[model samples]
Target: MGETIGYARVSTSGQKIETQALRLQEHGCSKVFQETYTGGSTTGRKALLGLLEYVREGDSVVVTKLDRLARSAMDLGQIASTLEDKKVDLVVLDQKIDTSSPAGKLMFNLIGAFAEFERDLIRERVQEGVNKAKEKGVQFGRKAKLTKQQLESLRNDFAEGELSKGQLAEKYGLSRSSVYRLVKSEH
Candidate 1:
């Protein structure tokens, strides 16, 4: 059996890992490795990598929470399963999950489910909000330099030779390319 190790993470400099470290040590962790950084797509959590390398069969790795280990369900799943493959058990104290037990396994699945569901719900809500805005006459495109009516008027003026491309651009606060586009559209 290898020594029990601790892994703690803080997303920002203002937060402290001392509480998590102390708890892990209290839970019989012999050595603790910790780091502070925003996480999600991090393939470079140095302390976590170090802990993984330090462990052997029967070695335990403790964390404060699953979210501290990963920002998303997929990332959490990968890291948790990797630890399991290494014969390293992960104990997330705050989540009350210990991957070495059947109950813990159930909890892991539930956490993953909830996390995925939350993200999906948020995405759906955002789309619904945008749809509602559109229904309420909100514009869904980039601001136009000239409206349809203004563009048509410009095209008519250019066709009648009342406005040259460069002259139209200067007069209408449009680019030469835009004036040319209007003239071409008229033709």
Candidate 2:
């Protein structure tokens, strides 16, 4: 039998990993990796990255729940594929999923498919809401730093060559890049 490693994660510092860690220990995990990360993507999760690097062929990775392992079905599929390629087993305690068994693998795939479908539905709904808001004249993105009158005045001042771009930016309480962008927009 290979070594069993554990991973414990909480989305925020306010949450605790003690419960998950204890459960992993009781489940015979020799070492437990822990992290507190709020990002939906796993790119910035240091502990998870480290755990993935440390596990070798025949080793097993255990997590209390699937959500602790990944935020989305695509992410879960990627992680699971990585483990599969490395010849490592994945065990999700709450879901009773063990990739070492055929039935467990099937169950994991089904869950991932459902999760992906749900995410797609949510995305479609959000896009529809955004479209409706736009139709109602709701503006998105950052507000313009300068009004039309201010832009015209700035353009005229630049055309007159009385002051440099830096001077104009200082007078308008804007950056040199902003001044350049505004001046360029006029053309």
Candidate 3:
């Protein structure tokens, strides 16, 4: 009924944007915006942002797959919400999600909920891993690689006033902070 605008993107330069473009043209899209680079995030994507900016109330944005539009579920929700806000709809050919339909709206909500759930699960898994690591006495962040012997040598040097922290770090292939930690750990 209104203008159909196609937006196509390939993660890499080598991907054939032509197939999607041809599909869009066959679907009678007036024009298409094809991006050659990966849009992993919303911040640096010029073409995707431009497509969103140019979309009007009566126009529809088409894509081959939902993933082509976003990298993560959060990203998908954000972009979809923008289209919803602008009174525009999305036609993800692979997903068969025409946001103009009740089924499509339901599908979108379901997908968003699933994505959120996935994020929560990943967070929980990470916390569990951290807890397990702590139980095993596995230190997080950068570890103190120096042995007791090396630390003892550092302490001996410091006690004799032969080397400052900087010189000790230089001599031992460690940072000044590492030297300080080594000195503290020895005693």
Candidate 4:
């Protein structure tokens, strides 16, 4: 057996990492890496990257929760793979996951699969909701900048060639590109 390392993270600076650090100490972690990072992705997590690089064969990496270690199933899988490659074990206290045993490995894989499945279900449901809204004639994106009357008047002004496109855009509080698009759209 090698050294036991711990990693703890909170999403924002306001949150305290002392609780996680205490738990890791109780779990026999000799060194603990702590950071405040958003759990959206593994990017910009220097502590995590350092912990991964620091561990060696026979070493164990411990965390209070699987979520504290990774943002998504894919991220967890990648981190797990890296640890596996380094011949290091992962111990997640809250989930009771210990990758030093066969059963723990199985449990970790199962949990990752379930998390990915849940995300996929959520994405599908959201798409269905969006499609239903579209069917019911719900418009999306930004509303038109100009009203129909305003558009007609602008078109009439452009046809008379009295004002330049820039002048028309200024009058309507629109960009020059918007004016060009509006005038070109008629043809």
Residues 22-119 of candidate 1 have per-residue lDDT tens digits of: 99899888898989877755488888777777888888888877777776778778877888888888888888898889999889878866876776
Pairs that collide in candidate 1 are none
Error of 3 at 53 (Å): 3.1
Clashes of each: 0, 0, 0, 0
When 1 and 4 are scored with lDDT, the better candidate is: 4
Whole-model lDDT values for every prediction? 0.81, 0.91, 0.82, 0.92
lDDT by residue (1-187, candidate 3, tens digit) is: 6689998888888789999889888887898998887655677878899999999997899988766777567788899899999999888887788889989988866765675576678879999999999999988897666667877888889788878888988988999987777677625
lDDT of 4 at 142: 98
Error of 3 at 98 (Å): 1.3
lDDT for position 102 in model 3 = 86
Top candidate on TM-score is 2
| lDDT of residue 146 for candidate 1 | 84
How would the candidate models be sorted by lDDT, starting from the highest?
Answer: 4, 2, 3, 1
Identify the runs in model 3 with alpha carbons over 4 angstroms from their true place.
Answer: 1-51, 63-77, 137-143, 180-187
How well is each residue in 1-187 modelled by candidate 2, as lDDT tens digits?
7899999999989999999999999999999999999637889899999999999999999999887888688789899999999999999999999999999999988876776677679889999999999999999999977777888889899899999999999988899999888888734
RMSD of 3: 5.2
RMSD of 2: 2.9
Off by over 4 Å in 2: 9-28, 35-46, 71-74
Please state the error at residue 113 of candidate 2 in Å.
Answer: 1.2
